[model samples]
Target chain A: MSIVRLLIGGATPRALALLAALLAFLVAAPAFLGPYALSVAILILYFAFVGQAWNIMMGFAGQLSLGHALYAGLGGYIAAGLFFHYGIGPWVGAFVAVAVAVLAGCIVGYLGFRFSLAGVYFALLTIAFSEFTRIAFDHWTWAGGSGGLFLKVQGGVTDILNLRGGATLFYYAILILAVGAFVLCRLLLESRLGRYWLAIREDAEAAQAVGVPVFRCKMIAIAISAALTALAGVWNAFYYNNLFPETAFAMGRSIEITLAPIIGGLGTLFGPIVGAVVLTGMGELFTDLTEHLKISGLKQIFYGLALLVIVIWRPAGVWPWLAKRLGVEERGR
Target chain B: MSGARLEIEALGKRFRGLRAVHDVSFAVPAGAIHALIGPNGAGKTTIFNMIAGVFPPDAGAVRLDGRPISGLRPDLVCAAGVGRTFQIVKPFKGLSVLENVTVGALHRHADLETARERAGAILDALELGDRRHQLAEALTLPDRKRLEVARALATEPTLLLLDEVMAGLRPTEVDRMVTFLRDLNARTGITVLLIEHVMRAVMALAAHVVVVSSGEKIAEGTPAEIARHQAVLDVYLGDAAGDAA
Candidate 1:
């Protein structure tokens, strides 16, 4: 264990150097790339951030949430609506969104925990809530209902006042959010709560027998997960300058968020990031291939196949494989 | 004698139509090693379960230090200074031996460092220091029993309810356990309520003995007194009473 720690401590400098170089590369990429490519990069970072947020609940705490996108959608809509109607900045609106998400998360967590609902049942509850919220939002015309709300396009490129600007702004903004989410998850996974969560995940009955407040720990996980996911929602709203219930709160969107962590490695710190990169890269590659071949629904088919293959071949996910190569200790039961 | 007392009054637990335990009553006085001896299906474990709050009795009450604790959650019962080990030891199979005890320590000490320190001390005292890093599932049956006791002890319970801890141990192992229990009770003054089938060990260690037959307390007295009781001889000794000459 000391040797593992020493290796990790020694690698910190090199890791930081690599991260710095990657940041530099990303910062410079938009300067030379076309508008389309930059948009894709921004989307990749956005998914990675949301994936990390979802990872906190599902990966770390082992709480499967099929409706996590509800928090993200609600967060984005609340922030975007508040800003559009009351002249609130996205910065202030983001906190409100997070607060709302936490409250909603608590409600969901309480209902689930109170009834001792877990495994597939908990996942089903999340989906049910998200679907209910989506339908309600679809009928609410203030945010344009099913037609969706589109932000007024600013005439100039440097329209920072309205948070509507060029591709560079979105890219940098999402990069920061993704990095922040990664750091937040890292800190949480190393803290006392992390071990408690792991214990609960491994054996909740035994954990409670030993004095871990199982419900409270699970609630905390949900709140943190919701708060981080809401921040991603705020980013989604600002970057796109649009809100639509079907697209934002869809089950497909939740699955997309869950897939990153599932594919990369469910519980590891870097699993979500790796998963996000692979899913996003594959998505982009598939889109290009489909466009050239004029194949309909090819991307979804490919993604489904990929998921099935990964589950069959490497059920533990990509992180274990990467950990072996990188000499990091594998963490999950 | 640390003033630990466990009292069960008219405790009745019925499963569907069958009464597993009926009107069973017993008191384990402070600082005494009390043994509950019964034949198989005599409701010894069911009585322990009720005291440990595994299930609330259909009728009657359980008290710890004169405070009613019946129907309370298991963790709350533990917090009220009543710690229990299961008849079938349920250690956290995935966790290491040290981590298993750490969970108990965490109940009283929230801080991981303090919990770890307390757990380490317990492992040392239990002679489990060498196997602290091994997963609990890999431990031998005797070690698992020790770990169960250690885990319960880490909770710092004033009253320790040990259920058939020596069930599968060999004679020598049982002797070593008897010595450990004697030392623990003598030094720590943690009141012990042990349910056991080993008549020899129970007779040697228990200061007070309660004999149960078919969920009813047929006898309660000192070890020697119970040993001489004809009812105990009839219920427990059975045909072996002739060999006891």
Candidate 2:
């Protein structure tokens, strides 16, 4: 019975099956798709990865951060600058970017926790810090100030040394990252830290009264969340081959990254992925419809309406309703 | 049985201009039931908060097993073997009854399995085994009070500070709670410092009683002595001393 249950009930087997299906689709995708379609797929996965990383802090740890794009921007700039200036490979640069982002996350976490700032106050602090970083980066001229930095266009499929080889390479690289982010979130959801995080989220004072080191646990959550988001930034820079302070550090970008998890199911393991797919798919449809009809501002109006409807009708997000329908156990309730 | 002793010297707490606890000094001996009784605003809960490291005292020292613990955080104080339950009962509403207890167990026990085992044992002992899987918010008032005790017990504290565990209990429920407290102190040898307004329960359970009125220690004695004392009678029955007769 145990063996039978394990075969049917374990997340591992289900995840493996899903991976196999996705791999099959990816391998056959290029044969049947054009450049635009492939680009859309890459964008979906990129947002999915970022959403998952953000979910770790906001959803799981219950620390609402509104300026997550700051870490992403920092990671992207660090990796892009390292590659452009020192001719360093993105593989090594990604790790350094992640480390720096983790350090920044720790600082933010310390400030919030040490001051006992929580809920909306913590979110405001993150926004304030991100805005500060954005202003500082905008003034720094080494990375082209407010103009931007663009990588040189390469002419081959195998220019792996330059980290701007081919569209197909970028696609596969981001796919791996998306999968890695999902696995990391899954691991966190099932671990001791996850339980501690849930306890702290539920009642921080009570958790401390029970001897849970509230500050240290929160800092750990922030660090892990920042590191993962930074790694996604590395891929973002490499895939686009262009970095700009405004585009990378915009408050809109942070909101876009968070919207996926909010619409998917905040705090649930699969909420970010589900949310990313829905939003990205809808965005693609909206863009195509607007272009064909020559309509102005339709996409923005649609997104705003959708967000309002979701918040009003199903505030828990799409994944929770889907989980109930499909009989799947939800995590971090 | 080998729990640490709690000592408070010159403990004082002020809320703005008013002194809540003034020069309060007491010692909770290991493995004994001590009661702090007072009127509505006698600073009983304030003393508990200061002792449990909820907030630093204005001018005092709290020593746990002879180690100075006045400036430590609540979690640090808990780790050092001091556990307390709030008078209002602050349970993690989203977590299950067992999970709420498990959070306390996680302090001393690192692994989930061991913590679960300990939590299960505590739940059974607290007569909450039937509602182990229920959300804490779903529990009734009496159950919530039981959960508070269970949560504190799971922390494995040497000294337990209970604030009005029998505050709203009926006569039978109060008797049961008194029996449970007595059994816990005798069996686990956990030193109990209870702040209660229920005169009957306090007189029946507490070996030593300390009374406070208007943030001052008005009387300290055994149950019979306190019940017969003129000061306690005046404080409870008011200035009309002839009304008691």
Each candidate structure's TM-score, on Cα atoms with residue i matched to residue i, is 0.86, 0.92
Candidate 2 structure quality by residue, lDDT tens digits, A1-333: 233332233455555576578768966776777899988888888888899999888887789999999899989989998888888888889889999999999989999999999999999999888888888888888777788877776767666665677778888788788877877776666555776787888888877888888898899999988998898888888878898888888899888989999999888877888898889888888888888889899988887887789878888899888877756555323
Clashes of each: 0, 0
- All candidates: CA RMSD (Å): 4.1, 3.0
DockQ of each: 0.37, 0.59
- Lowest lDDT block of 10, candidate 2 chain B: B236-245
Q: All models: lDDT?
A: 0.83, 0.84
Model 2: per-residue lDDT, tens digit, B128-189?
A: 99999888999999889999999988899999989999988888999988998898888888
lDDT score of residue B206 within candidate 2: 92
